[model samples]
Target: MQAPQTKEEKQLDISLDELIYKVRELKQSIAGFIYKLENEYQHISWPNMMEHFGVLSSQLNSVKRLLKTSKMPLLRNYVLFPLRLSPDRDLELEKLTEGRVMAFSHEVVPDYLRTKPEPEVEERVQMMSVKASSMAPDTTQKQLTNLNKITANLLDTISVPSASDEREKDSSLKNALPQTSSQQDTNLLIGAITKGHRLLRPEPQSPMVVGPQMGQMQPQMQQQHPHKLQMPGASMGRMPSAIKTNIKAAATSHPYQRP
Candidate 1:
């Protein structure tokens, strides 16, 4: 059986219940603020957003401390069980509360302050673009000037030949032997002189017995003295004596007189 509750216990229970109710109300308020901030985030200021979060954090801390110190087993378990069961709820709550606070403070504040665009910045960008466009013509002119200079240099190089080229032409002219009428006459005179020298030189007499004449005479001689001719062995042995006799006969023969 359960014993009856004391006055102190009843008061503690009542205070714990009040604390729990206050925590619930605070959580609801924070949720409402988060919803409002989500919808109208751009409009809200940083200080206002932070103030709301600070109040909520203080209330939550107060509630947590109260719950921790409470001796009521049912009250503590009832409040802590749901929070412990899903740790994500606390994280989500923190994200909803503090996350928006930081986002609003850092992100939203700067944007809110400078909602209107700066005329000077826009003008500066326009001026830079205009300057770049204007510079293009000057750059093209410079390029054209360089091209003209290069063309002029090329023309000068082609028109005026180098000293080496002039020297080559002069050397070619000097080396070429000219064929003037006087030079041709001199060449003809030298050829005439060479011809006269050749005419003055003594020439060797032609052989009396050529190869073809000797061949023809051999057959005729054989026919004329067929029986008188000695055998090859006797002719070889008596060749010198026969030659001496023929020479003596030719010398004794008469010289022919013209009638």
Candidate 2:
């Protein structure tokens, strides 16, 4: 008998052929997607939603195609994809933190702040301070009184005059000045005599010979006097003879008689 061809080998060969045809189809799809994306991106304005959305759509479609064509379950192997256990872990952590924050917010803090007193106590303190301020110091009052006394004493000292000195000055002026008319006349007569003596009878050392010459010349003066002519009373303006005789007698008795 000839050896039988195994059926398992036949199935393996068909599956392998099917996988190759799927890979070829995937390559063609990827090429068409790349061409379409490139054409749209180049023509599209940058920063537009359509340009970015088209790139993302192309990537997601490529990934789906790779997953569909491949034999391996690649979702289990990719670490960069956000479709794994990371989202569940993040959600669980956020829920736990929120619950903890709410519990803390509801808890109460202790009351440490204090309050002040009433208005009555403040008024009582102010009244006591006012009463204390009204009192005075004994020493300061005494010092002010002493200062006033000293000022009065200084005024008294400056106002008093020297009585005895004033009296002495007045008495001395009285003694020095002339008192009566007779004393003044005597003073005038003495001054006249002093001046006449100075002119007529000089000192012992004088160049003039005055005293004896004046005495000797008196007798010769009588003879020269009779020879000098005298006017008769009748020749004068209406002079009587009796009146002329009286005038001659008065002239002889007078101290100023010439001869």
Candidate 3:
């Protein structure tokens, strides 16, 4: 007689694809239930309403239970506060880390990270930090001073003028200009005199006949003297007298001559 053979175990693992299909089918069933109630309400009697609601409730509960028991859990997002951990901050780190579950897989870690820092190395690091801290202000101050000088040089090069300078320039220009009417006239007269021209006396005409008429003309000459020939009171429209018209001066070497 042969011994009884054992049956093979069925695969029990459910993949994400199977979960998605089941969830999609449940969602479709619930959606179709709502659609049916909305579309067939006029035809549906009051006795079928409770049954329809019951079917909807069962379908929703099935989907909820499936999601709760599935391999993938619901994801919740929250803010992660930034923190820096140091030897002095160990208490805060411990408080943060207390009662926190940790999970990890096999990963390669560098051996250098596992080794503790030597005391001499820590001392050198602290000294270097101190030296850097001491030099920071000096370097920053030097750079700031250099930038200030550069700005000052740029301001000088740009030549931003003041109102006072403009006023001074205007005042100088005004001073250079002629200030008085007399001065302006003098300037115009000088310009005219320098235009290459010279003044000359007028030409002479006929001389006086003083041979016989000297005695008789003495009284008339006294009445109408050379200064009285062009009388200011004479009528401009009147013809000149024969004696005054014929009594013109002769040309002479002398600059002064009588009429």
Candidate 4:
């Protein structure tokens, strides 16, 4: 009911313009598919994704078929010299001639476009280049001044004397220390220690009372500490006026007679 009258034909003699127009249409179709994928992929809900892929695959197949059936297969079986650049150490601009091998290095200008240098000028330049190979050294040198310690021996053996030094120190300490001769020596040591303690003892600093109602208190305190030693002249020099007054009062109250 839809297309019952249509018929299929096959000779397929296509013109170049028509073929190019078909290729452009295929390109447009592929570009439109890419545009949809980039901009409207999230918004579009695809009913059949495979069918759209199949259309693109079919387009690719048609392009392959066209290339395969053409007079020229267009295989890159041989290298075209001008398309790729290769290094040539012997390559010189002045020696370039027609049909000479050329490469796209430094300058890719054609032979006809290159202006030939003068022979005298070229010779002088070559001589100058040859003379000045280099007077300076390379960027780096062998570092002979490194901090690597080189020795004939590696094992460290500690001498017996070094271990004996600590033992010797212990023995020397035992010899240097004084030994107790008898009980008299111990008594003498005790007397010296007691004298040191007596010398280091701080003198008592009693409050001075120079005003009224303190006369009775002073006499009582002096009576209680009558045997208290008097401070030396050197110590009395550092004493305040009140301390001097108190010391004088205590000395006056002392019961010492000029015996």
lDDT by residue (1-259, candidate 3, tens digit) is 2333111111112434555667666767777767878898778877677776777677677666766664543422222333422333245434544523121112212222235467788899999898877787979799889999999998876654443355678675555555656664564455336421111011112224335534543544344222233322222212353333233432343367656
Residue lDDT tens for model 2, 1-259: 2234455445445655665556555556667657766777676565564655676566666556655664533334434322222212344545755543222211211111113345788899889888766657676578789999999998766654343345677675555455545664564456336432112332234537557655644554354232222223113322333544577787877888797
Clash counts for the predictions, in order: 0, 0, 0, 0
Better of 1 and 4 by lDDT: 1
lDDT of each residue in 148-187, candidate 1, tens digit only: 9999999887855553466677665544435445664564
Best by TM-score: 1
- Judge candidate 2 against the unseen true structure and give its global Cα lDDT, from 0 to 1: 0.50
Error of 2 at 210 (Å): 99
TM-score of 2: 0.17
RMSD of 1: 43.4
Q: All models: lDDT?
A: 0.58, 0.50, 0.49, 0.50
* lDDT agreement of model 4 with the native: 0.50
Estimate the lDDT of model 1: 0.58
**Top-scoring candidate (lDDT):** 1
